[model samples]
Target: MLINETIITDIKNIIAHSKDKAIKAVDHQRTLMYWHIGERIFEEEQKGKDRADYGTFLIKYLSEQLQPEFGSGFSIRQINLYRQFYRTFTNVHTLYAQLSWSQYKLLLSVNSQDKREFYIAETIKNNWTVRQLERQIHTSLYERLLLSNDKESVLAVAKKEKLPSDAKEIIKDPMFLEFLGLKKESAYYERDLESAIITHLQEFLLELGNGFSFVARQKRIHIEGDEFFVDLVFYNRILQCFVIIEIKTHKLTHQDIGQLQMYVNYYDRTEKLPHENSTIGILFCADKNDAVVKFTLPENQKQIIASQYELYLPTEQQLMAELNKELENFEERDKPKKEIQ
Candidate 1:
């Protein structure tokens, strides 16, 4: 009576899968328990609204009793957080099975409803882990996207309500490269920066924006005996185009734009299929003058974009400054139209 190895292996796999599902079920149950507790606390607090300190008194008393036998999760702070969580996410139906309690805790900190909704949609769509969500939030991904696009458009793309029609809708400007571990003061060559991006390719892709897949690096092209190499090439599934990037570790100039435009042209003429959209070119430079970029390209040209790169995640002050600058630019651009009207 010999035992079959295949049967034993199958049983082991089944047990492992069952354990995983059971763990998920228990986590979800715990989440539901917290929600119920929060719901009860809110209801109780509402009834005692005559007294100003009633809510505080109720939570403190509950924590004292619950913490002894039910464990530390019912501490005063935890109870308050649970109440806040309920208030933030009023509808339990909107709570996703994929999101854990830890992830919800992070989402609760997002003050803007629209921003939180966008994060929720992205987290579910991308299957982001707790750490990934935290990183995106910490790096101010939502605010960065808003700098280049309107709020509605950004939310629409994240929620999959609409597919991106143009690169600007998805690609972020002043792209953060803190994950590359490059020093802001370091004198990096073009090759050095390109190598850093390749080394942290996955994080770079996340920073690049949605639907970008790596195609090649230092891609060589020959044009009538002239040879050129593109620093990085990517294909965006959402926009249905090839994105060619040229790295410049110095202030961008008209010549840099011209060089990137040539790469874009080459890809459009020789590589892009008829059904696909035009090839997009990006001049990823250390610094750029917006006036120079605006004047360098043709008025009707939309394929070429010049974006600055940042070596580190921006502080809140830096983000606020960028937002203010964008607002000022918008106002200035609208002034002429307002006068005409």
Candidate 2:
């Protein structure tokens, strides 16, 4: 009387798809409902000539009458949100069906329309949850992306219209890992930090930028009787290359850079296929002296990169300061080369 395994598997897939579809349908209906409500409210407000004081009374009256029968979700705060949601989005045709009401609410809070649209594009492409949406906004991800890229490229990447050509397009120098729940002041080993990243792997991937897929942790390599373990390994589909990450909890040195270069070479010689691009190495450290990094690697190097990790998200002022410092260092590095030529 047992069911066939093939039949059972097919039934499970069907049910899973059905559940996902049902949830999506419910979300779409809710978003549309709010949009329609906002449209009605807007039309009603026009009778009062869009007067702010009349609009306030309208929302207040509606909230009081709606609360008893409809529920607390129709409170004054939520009513205001609904009005703002429609006002922000404006056209019904532009509403994203895939986004939830909560996601839209978060997007509406962003003041810059360009930034808001970029977040929307990213959220839709990444299938991010409401919490992820909130975290990205709070971290000022839009501003950070602007630090390296232009406004057009940032929007283009979020919309998946263009792929990242080099690491600079996707790599954030000071990676924000505040979501990992690790303290910057705490004394910890490299292994401890690696473990935290592995545990929060999803958040880690999001922080890693785009097209990265985790392949291994403590990846082991062997040559004759010797063994070496890499901290992390990932593949970037967009770059068509393997990305090797080495974790160092202290300041980076020439030796650390050399070690990472060797790892990249190992992957190129052994692990990489002829059709694939050269492997890239990322040396993740707590502190990086630009002088050490510049002098350690080949001046023409493209496959090696050094980036610092931060445990906390910085304020706008702090982020701007860091951006200015990075710009200054780049100019300094370019100055000597300009003089030589």
Candidate 3:
């Protein structure tokens, strides 16, 4: 009698799943083992206050003994990582079980406590792989978010303490697009840039900040027999509105802003449901003149945003200058309100 094919298939599937489960269990146990090592190291250092200065030597000695008996897993670098992992998450009870040892190694490098906490929460929430976590840290995602928002607000966003109430909170200026692999001095058409963004859509959306989902590409609309195409359209779940984007590969003009505003108006008038908020329009340009943007839009404009995109990451000095300028603008905006009060 021939064996049933379905029975054989089911048996093979079960073996594969069991193998995966066993691997996960082994990885988790290894993480626990490292944590215990770190905990013991810390406790020993604490008991002898004078020996606290010997942390460097202590880790080296442990690595020497452990590497020979237990394989190269106990290298000096890894021993230090374990020590850092414990220091970073002091409470053993709060250790994240889902994160691999590799992910913990990355989180240890984040210097800021608040920023590290944000990354931890995001990693767990999104189920990020080791590579994704590395990418977010490398691109300074936290610092970029801080560009348009206060520190507390950024923390709140990370912790889900407060939802984004406006477009500014979610729209990042000078978005980093190095992942697109575009050259800084390359002369590419608007269509080419748009296509590159679509190709690396996930990275582009991450650079765009939170709660955005792609709706359409070159979304077409008809107005009184004339047809216009919006470069990209997205819906912001947090803001409960449509985000219409127009790409300009050159310096932004008043006319460019006007055209984006027209798209915003069209969506607001015809597409938006009564329950949803006003649609937001973004003029994603290669360069924008502040004076031109200020004079082009109404003083009370809140929905239309003009943001510049960068093909590569900005230098630390350049980022600092931009941050200072943003802070100055914030102060100026608050001054009028404070004086009125």
What are the RMSD figures for all models against the true structure? 2.5, 3.3, 3.4
lDDT of 3 by residue, 211-313 (tens): 8899999998999999999999999988999999899999999999889989999999999999999999998899989789989888877998888888987
Q: Which is superior by lDDT, 1 or 3? A: 1
Q: Candidate 3 deviates by what RMSD?
A: 3.4
Show where candidate 3 strays beyond 4 Å: 1-25, 51-53, 314-341
Order the candidates by lDDT, highest first. 1, 2, 3
Tens-digit per-residue lDDT, 1-341, candidate 2? 88678988899999999999999889988998888889889889999975769999999999999989999889999888889888998999998888888889888879988999899998988889999889888777776666556678888888889887767667778788998898878988999999999999999999887789999999999978999999999999989999999999999999999988888999999999999999999999999997888888878678988888899878867876777777666556556554564
Please give the distance, in angstroms, between residue 322's alpha carbon in candidate 1 and its true position after superposition: 2.4
Report lDDT per candidate: 0.89, 0.87, 0.85
Evaluated at residue 85, the lDDT of candidate 2 is: 84
Query: Which one wins by lDDT: 1 or 2?
Result: 1
Better of 1 and 2 by TM-score: 1
